[model samples]
Target: MAFHRIFVLDLAGVGMGEAPDANRFQSVGADTIGHVAQQWPGDLSLPTLQRLGFGNIRITNPIPGIPPVEQPTGYFGRLHMAAQDNRRATGLREMWDYTGPIRTESVFTTLTAAGYSVTLAGPFLSYLATQTPAERFQVGTNQAAFQILYDRLNAPVSGLTYVVLPEFRFAGEQQDLEASAQALQMTDQHLAQVIHDLGANDLLILTATHAADQTFGPTPTREYLPLLVYSPSRQAGHALGIRRTLADVGATVLENYGVAPATTGHSLLNELTQ
Candidate 1:
């Protein structure tokens, strides 16, 4: 059977549980989509990567460093502080692209190779502020954007689509467990809408790259991560245990569509489809 479409919702840096009473945070490399694809179940991850059809695209990874870069040696060195602040305002995309390592393949590219059309969607902070200028002082979440994205995704596209929604991007500096839960709810609600619109015959997969209780070191660092999967095409269960590595996502997807992933990962597709 030829799988027609696929949709993925990727919420960046959405840590697991509640925020900790700590100072800094760490961003483990495995949490990114690329790493997740590497661990897909079976050997499907490899051939799939070759079929991605993205061409020779050079995607940049993000990096983080200070004191070493521009030590306050002189006036210009002091100005680096302001430069760092500007970097923060640009949003996490650049951060991940510049400082983050290329540990895994792109999730978007992998899915495309698997023969499923995909569409990644997300909201950047600066863009959100611009959209709702009046709500500059007020905190913003992906609730509204999630609704719009879900509606669009479920609106009967010509083929399968992958949509990534970084709910964490909407949560600004407010790092709280409630924020994480709210982000999940926001994701579920939009997904529910899509499922309702598409019906049970269509496939639905839900998962997270990693979880964060708080920052590790005021910058990104290697840390523990978790992954979740919910597919109507699979089993009907609520509140399943978390997967340690995000790579399992690829394996599970391949199994669901009857195509083996090219990489190695835990394939919970059996449980999900069970």
Candidate 2:
């Protein structure tokens, strides 16, 4: 199914569990979602994510309230950070395959060259917009960011929209489980609207740049990030398994628009569509 629009929601610092090399970074047993769920005073409801296969990523050890459903409406998976450090900048760079100091090439550039209008919205746009050719909307809050995305989706041009939500990250940094739970609820509500507004040719991806498990301390934890994919055109949802690198995301988007990836990652488009 060829999508006319693609939306990548970067839920920054929303990690699932510790990565393979978690001990090397002194972040062993760091699970952002797990800790948040366990400590959330009451039931932490995230119906939208649950329906999108959020709970399917971890079968053996599932999130408290968001258990794996029998039939999810989207694809679920995990992604390992390819960069040595778990910094947001490095994660974003790796996603677009930006390796050089002077970042000129990326998935955004490739999409632009392919005649796809790309819009980037988030509080941390400066970290990425300066390096890419996509239109930038530096929003201070998630509401404003989603508004820009909604506007872009209504626009006539076929394009890609990237949004970053830092609520979870902020809450995690503060080690506030209540705040984290609230952020999840609020974001899930917003996501519900996005899901409802999605066109048949629209694809939505929810992921995180790195893990910021509050249980692991104030610094970013080395952990596996969640990958959730949904499209109105998809017939059924399935597990996408664990992706090796974040670059696979860029590769999938480029392939969707008939563009070759300029980075070092395989595309999951085939698995997504087939």
Candidate 3:
């Protein structure tokens, strides 16, 4: 069950609920997915996510349409931001355990050093350009980003591919609940294709850097982001629980490649592989 390829999909602004320290940020009761589902005209169809344990996350806090299933195909969990604020840059850095003003090393660099090909796509490409030695592809929209990622997944290669979809973030910023819900549906459809195209050795991690709950305001909200891990080799899905930091993601990736993790978070590789 060793994974030769890992795909990290950052569905920006897709938060599940408020974080433990939401009050300090004046973001109590902020639930990106919940709000979008409630305000959305009808039950949001997310068959792909449901099969991946998206509904299981609602066992603690409910999302309108997604409900807990008897068995999920992947691991489900939520992650808390380790940074003081919910900034995009801070969240991304925390994923690799970077806390300094200037990041010297990251998951991308660590993977590259281990001889893994790292490819990054989406709007964050320029922001992360100087951090890692990766094959970067800048895309304009979420659709374009996912298309590029789909194309890469279909290629005959095994490595790490990271893509960030900003449409949700943009919709959240604009405070358009309808747009946000629509984008979620569209993303879910695209996710079905992505899952269908995944190879046996491919590992897919879906998460968010920060929550831009339109109901809260234009700024990012302090909220718990969704975490979904899927691989064809896994027999059944289980709850990963609340991760203290997003760095666990990087740790898991490094562990899969036999590279030691240089982060504060523990690796979930064992849990997923066991």
Instruction: Compare the candidates by TM-score and give the number of the best one.
Output: 3
Residue range 97-145, candidate 3, lDDT tens digits = 5322354557787778777888888775557787567888877688899
Q: State the lDDT of candidate 1 residue by residue for 38-120, as single tens digits.
A: 23332222221121211011112211110112111101100001112222332222211121134544333444465544444
TM-scores of all predicted structures:
0.48, 0.94, 0.94
Better of 1 and 2 by lDDT: 2
How does residue 216 of candidate 3 score in lDDT? Answer: 80
- List the candidates ranked by TM-score, beginning with the highest: 3, 2, 1
TM-score of 2: 0.94
How does model 3 score by TM-score? 0.94
Residue 138 displacement in candidate 2 (angstroms): 1.0
Clashing residue pairs in candidate 3 are none
RMSD of each: 17.5, 2.1, 2.2
Overall lDDT per candidate, in order of appearance: 0.35, 0.84, 0.84
Which TM-score value belongs to model 1? Answer: 0.48
Per-residue lDDT over 59-111 for candidate 2, one digit per residue giving the tens place of the 0 to 100 score: 99989888999999999999998778877678888887644345546788777
**Alpha-carbon shift of residue 64 in model 3 (angstroms):** 0.8
